[model samples]
Target: MTSPTDPAARQLLAQGRLEVEGRLVDASNVTLYCALELDGLSGHAVYKPVSGERPLWDFPHGTLAGREVATYLLSEASGLGSVPPTALREGPLGVGMVQLWVDTTDDELVDVRPPAEVPDGWRVVLHAHDRLGEPAVLTHADHPGVRDLAILDIIANNTDRKGGHVLAGTDGRVYGVDHGICLHSEPKLRTVLWGWIGEPLPSDAVEKLRALPEKIYGSLGEELSAHLNGVEIGAVVERAEKLLSTGVFPEPGDDWRAIPWPLF
Candidate 1:
C-alpha cells in the first residue's frame, strides 16, 4: 500500500539512524519523537510510523495523517503546496532536526512547552510557540487576511479549522497548520464560520481572488500543482470566481462549507 511511511521511510532510515526516544504526541497515531542519523548527520524529530493498531482513546476523526498532513498544510499557508526544507544530514543525537516546521524565521504556534522555556535542541524550531494564542476579533467586512484564509481552506478542501489550528504568531500575522485530511477527492469541507453565511461579500475580497490566478501562479502554483490535479485547480478557480461574483457571505453547499468545530 502507498503509505506515508513508504519510500520516504526507507530513505530516511537509510540516511539516518532511528532511535525511538518515546512518544511525543499521544493523539491519533502516537507520534514517537526519534533521533535519526542522515549519513553522518543526525538530529531529533518526531517520527510517526504507520501501524494497524488503533488507539484506545478517541481522537478527533482524521487525526492520523501525521507529518504528511502537516506538510500539506504548510504548503497551503506558503501558497506553495510542496516547498522543500533543508534536508537534515545526520550529525549527532538530540539536535539538528525538526519534522514539522512553520516558518523558520517566524515564531511558530505549534511548539509544545511553557513560554519561558525557549525551544532548543532543534535550530529551526527554536522560535516556535508552545501554545497558540487568542484569535483576533473579525473587526471588518473587508479583511483581506481572513478572506485569504477562506480561499485557502476552499482550495485545500479543509474540513476542520479548530481555533487552535489558527495560530496567532507573536508577530502580528496569522498562520494555520494541520491539514492531514484535506485536498481529498471528496467534499468534506466543514468549519465553524457559519455566521458569515449569506452575508454580503466585501468587494475587496472579490478583487483579491480575481487577481490571484495570475498573481499566485508564479510562486505558489508550481508546488500546489504538483500535488493537486488539473481538475482540482480548475475547481478552485471556479469557486473563487463564484465567490467573487456574489460579493457577499456565501451559503455554500455542504461540499464547500466548513466544519463546525473550534480548536479552543
Candidate 2:
C-alpha cells in the first residue's frame, strides 16, 4: 500500500474516519487495526481507546492514549521522527489514540541468535538459552537510527521498551511504538537498547536534547498538559535537562528492573 505524505498522514490522523479493520490479537491492550480516510486520503492506522486500557497501579487510569500522543509529540520535538504520526481523536469506540501503521514486511529482527552465528556490528545486550537449550544472544544493530531511538526513549522515560515495540519501517527507517507507559515522574526506564549505555552521546543526539526545552515549553507542552499531570510533564523536562548535561547514554540503575518481560 502507498503510504501518504507526512502532512497528509497527520491531517488524516487529526481528522479521519477510523474504520476498524480488525483487532490485533498480539497486543496486551485493546488495539484495533484500522483504516483512516479523510478528504480522499486513505491509510492504515492503529487505534487504542482509553476505555479499553487495563488499569496500571503506577500510571493513572485511562491516560494511555494521551501518553501515546505525547510520545509522538516528543518524537517531533526532538526531530528524531522515529514515531509514526499520531493524534488523540474520537473514534467509533470513543476517544482514543490513532497512529499511522508502519509497513514492516521488509523488516528484520534486531538480533536473536548465538554469538558465534551473529553478524558483525551487532551489539549483544545479554546471553540466554533458547527453547532448544542452545545459547542465544539478544542484540541490536549498531546503527544511527537505533541510537536515535534509544535517545528518544530516554527523553520520554519509557517504561516498556520491548523489542517488538521497535519496528523497522519498509522505508528503511526505525519506528518505535506502544508508548502508553511513558513520561512518568519516577524513573521507570526498561528496554533492550542498552548496547550504547555509557557511550558518549552522538553530537546530533546531544543537539536534539538541548533543543527539547523550547519544544516542551511551546505547543508540545500545552498539548501534553491536557493529557498528562503536572508531575509527568515536569519529569519530561527534567529528563531532557539531565540527558543534556550528562552527554552520554545512561546506565540502568540498580533500583529498578532494567529489561522488560517477554523480551520479544
Candidate 3:
C-alpha cells in the first residue's frame, strides 16, 4: 500500500522537522537527517531517509519511488541486509513523519554509523576500516551469507557495495546495507562476493527466490512500478528467475566486473 502516489507520504513530509544548531536540515529532495527513538531499542539514532531521487540514481527509480519495496526485498533475504526502520507516526520530533530510526547495534545490521558525531556541525566522508588496515577486505570464502549477498546484489543490479557497506556483527553474522544503488535497468552490479565462486545455491534459498517474482509483482512490485519503468521492474524479476534456474552466478555482463589486473 505504500506507493509513490500515497497521500499520507506528503502529509508526513510536510510536518516532520528536525534541527541541527538551529538550522533545519533540508527535506526538499526527500532526504532528511533526523533523530528517532523506538520502543525496546537500545538508543536514539540519526537517520537519513532516501525517497527515490537523483543522488541515489546509482539505482534509478530507486531512492525516489521503490524504497519501501527494496526494504521488503531485503527483509525477505535470509539474514542479508537491514530491515526497514519502523515508520514513526508520532514522536518527540512532531507528527506525520516517515522516518526509520537507526538504533540497532546488532552486528547483523550494516555499519551505517554517521561520520564521527560533532557538536551539531559536522561534515566528512566516513572511511571504512577493520583491524588489519584502511581498505578492509573479507578473506574467508566459505561464508554462506556472503555468497547469498553476492547473488542478491547481482539480481538487484547494485553498483555501490562499498567495503563499509558490509557489516560484521558480534554475533558472527554479516549484513549488507545502502542499497540505494540497486535495481538498475542497466547492468551496474559491482560487489566482492566472489568468495564462493562455484558453490551451488542452497535449495531452500532458491525456493524462496523463485517465489519472489510473483510476490513482488503482486503488491510490492505494483508499489515499486509507480516509481520505475516496467522494463526495469521486469529486469529485476527476470534476474531473479535466472538465479532460481541456474543456482549459480550467471555470466557477468556488466562493465563493473573485471577490475584491472595487478600491475606488479
Question: How displaced is residue 132 in candidate 2, in Å?
Answer: 3.7
How far off is residue 121 in model 1, in Å?
Answer: 41
Candidate 1 lDDT, 1-264, residue by residue in tens: 111223454355436566777774534544556665555544554544435225424223232333244335334444532222213223233222224322223444333344344344211111223235622222112234444555566555566755445544333445455444455435655643333556676555555567756643555455445445555555555655666677665554744534443333
Which RMSD values do the candidates have, in order? Answer: 11.6, 1.5, 10.4
Ranking by TM-score: 2, 3, 1
Best-to-worst ranking by lDDT: 2, 3, 1
Worst 10 residues of 1 by lDDT: 121-130
Model 1 whole-model lDDT (C-alpha atoms) = 0.45
Query: What is candidate 2's lDDT per residue for 1-264, written digit by digit as tens?
Result: 336336678888888888999999988889999988887888899999988888899896338999999888888877764898889999989999999999875555475888798778888888999999999999987877788888888888888988888888877788889999988889999989899878898888778778788877888889888888877888888998998888888999899999898787
- The sequence of per-residue lDDT tens digits that candidate 3 reaches over residues 1-264 is 122223443333333443322212342233444532223222222233342134642444434324444543444532333333324233333322243323223332222232342223221122455445435323323456555666677677776665445555434545555555567777766654444444577776687687777776687677566556788878877877877777776655555652211100
Candidate 3 ranges with C-alpha deviation above 4 Å: 1-34, 38-46, 49-74, 77-141, 170-172, 257-264
What is candidate 1's CA lDDT for residue 195?
36
Highest TM-score model number: 2
In model 1, which regions exceed 4 Å deviation? Answer: 1-26, 30-147, 215-220, 252-264
TM-scores of the candidates in the order shown? 0.49, 0.95, 0.59
* lDDT against true structure, model 2: 0.85
